[model samples]
Target: MTHTIRRLLTGTALAAILAGPALADETIDITIVNGHPPIFLWVKHLTETFIPTVNAALEGSGYTINWTEAYGGTLAGVGGELDAVEDGLAEIGAIPTVFLPTKVPLQNVTYNTPFGPGEPQVVMEAMDALYAQIPGMAESWHQYDAEYLGGGFALDNYILMTNFPVTSIDDLAGHRIAAPGPAVNWLEGTGAVGVAGNLTTYYNDIQTGVFDGVIVFATAAAPARLHEVAPYVTVTGFGAQSAGALVANQTWLQDQPEAVQEALRAGAAAYQQAYIAEQTQRVAAAMATIAPDEAHLHTLSDAERARWAAALPDVAGTWAAAADGEGLPGTEVLNAYVQILRDAGVPLVRDWSQR
Candidate 1:
């Protein structure tokens, strides 16, 4: 062949090699479900930040996803997320372990041991590390046929929103106070009656006198306008909580292309960062709107906070022991999480692991 012809052939081969990866690209379908609607900050981040981040990362990659978002109880109601993913109704979900205490007892360690760390960033860092370090921690999700991707602590700290001002613990006598999940345990020793309630019905419940007030996070209570009804906001420092997690169907995840799997994992990590950043920023910004008249924010004296924490039963020990009985490293996780808080200089109202 002539030199010119040889050069032409070489150029053609180079062009094909350059086009190979793009030609190999594939599009896959993914269905994401959240029992709760996008109104919640976490779910909002899932749709607004998580999905966009995943899609952006996959751009120009060999795999693209056709996402189907099923939220707002369209596919499953609250507490139905675990089964929805396990049954293959959705490929992934934001499963709130707080709601599935019986099904995923181990993940509730944060809820069980309260008043440790009030910062969401601190709790999130500790929880994320435990999920990686402790044996069988992630396997808790495996039991439900789901893979844990990533999760974060939802609130900065728990507070009280009530119609009546809480001047002292004695003031809670004979009153009904609502809390979500194991949070009711925070109210155990106080004279207040703890009722199981969630944000969706808090307004109605209080309006109908189902409960006199609620213990909730400031970020959430502000947006939901809990201040409108229960104008007295007491900063109880009940500690931040591990509310939910990003999980994918184990079988479906295993069958996915390697790139797709990585994208899902990447998306979850991004979601955690986005969520914590928003929560951290939101606490001050949201509270700015709920000032004196609209709502009164009072911090429970450190002495009072410690007294409340000390008065509660050994919920952490009980929880850990129950987990150990079921063949899990509950004690190890509990210790590690508490130590993480201590190392971060978080003021603990009670050292749960020590008890």
Candidate 2:
């Protein structure tokens, strides 16, 4: 009787040991620091669409991802977010790749060259496929000790909007224009004063006269009601951005069972596809409202656009140099990406690294 009782206790202990890790794998509590503004259309996708979709994907499997709102500064803010993730303040967060250009320069390769067609889907396709081929791409995340489970493209190309009437590039000079970081360099000789403002703040600031004009993309513009402040919109012929990634902490991910990893990958791809479709519809709806005269839907003239492209070399060079110091294959990967963009029919004035 004593021997039988001891054996039963030992068997129970062994069962507990075997079950603990698997149970932990089935449930994960991750906080998604909502990089987008709560009201923005993209936010809807992140909160309403993505969470439920990912949950459904993992439903029967008993695995789950818990995302909590950490809107911009509401939790970690722009600069400190990667640190927030690293320290485990929040298990997971959405970061804008552009915001941390110095810390994550390699991710911004698509932003430097802007001549690709501005559609969101194509830009997403190129970046997704591009990263899979580049060994350096995956390695970019490793240095930070994070795992890049998957990445999604950012909203498509940017558009120009202004509080007052502006018709031509000549009109852009001497205005208080808010430009996204890398593209801010593109605006240099054009004579626009660069004010560093992000999408989250642009709408409110634009209405209040913090800026007379803004360089922003359409997908976000409509939701922000940019038209209310800036009646004039210009669809600058440029590529969309691939600026979001779903990264997991290397420490945490390594301990997970193989089944959990597979589920996360599939969910990431689904989120990317849904975001692309959702954004495409929003951009179309936004574009439909403005009269042709008011919205100026046309590409920059070839000669003028050539001048714009010529201005990109310094921006790319500066970025590559910064990246190299971090021990990343910056110059090589940056140049290779540029060539890929060109080979795919993107327009280029000067190669950032090599043709």
Per-prediction TM-score: 0.91, 0.84
Q: How far in Å is the alpha carbon of 159 misplaced in model 2?
A: 1.3
Best by TM-score: 1
- lDDT for each of the candidates? 0.84, 0.70
- Looking at model 1, residue 283 earns an lDDT score of 88
lDDT of 1 by residue, 280-335 (tens): 88888766665455337677898988888888899999989988899988899999
lDDT of model 1 at position 66: 86
Off by over 4 Å in 2: 1-26, 62-69, 290-299, 311-313, 349-355
Cα lDDT, model 2, residue 285: 73
Runs off by more than 4 Å, candidate 1: 1-25, 293-295
For candidate 2, the per-residue lDDT at 351 reads 63
Query: What does candidate 2's lDDT look like per residue over 185-224, in tens digits?
Result: 6577676788877877887888888898787877677667
- True-vs-predicted CA distance for residue 154, candidate 1, Å: 2.5
**By summed lDDT, which 10 consecutive residues of candidate 2 come out lowest?**
290-299
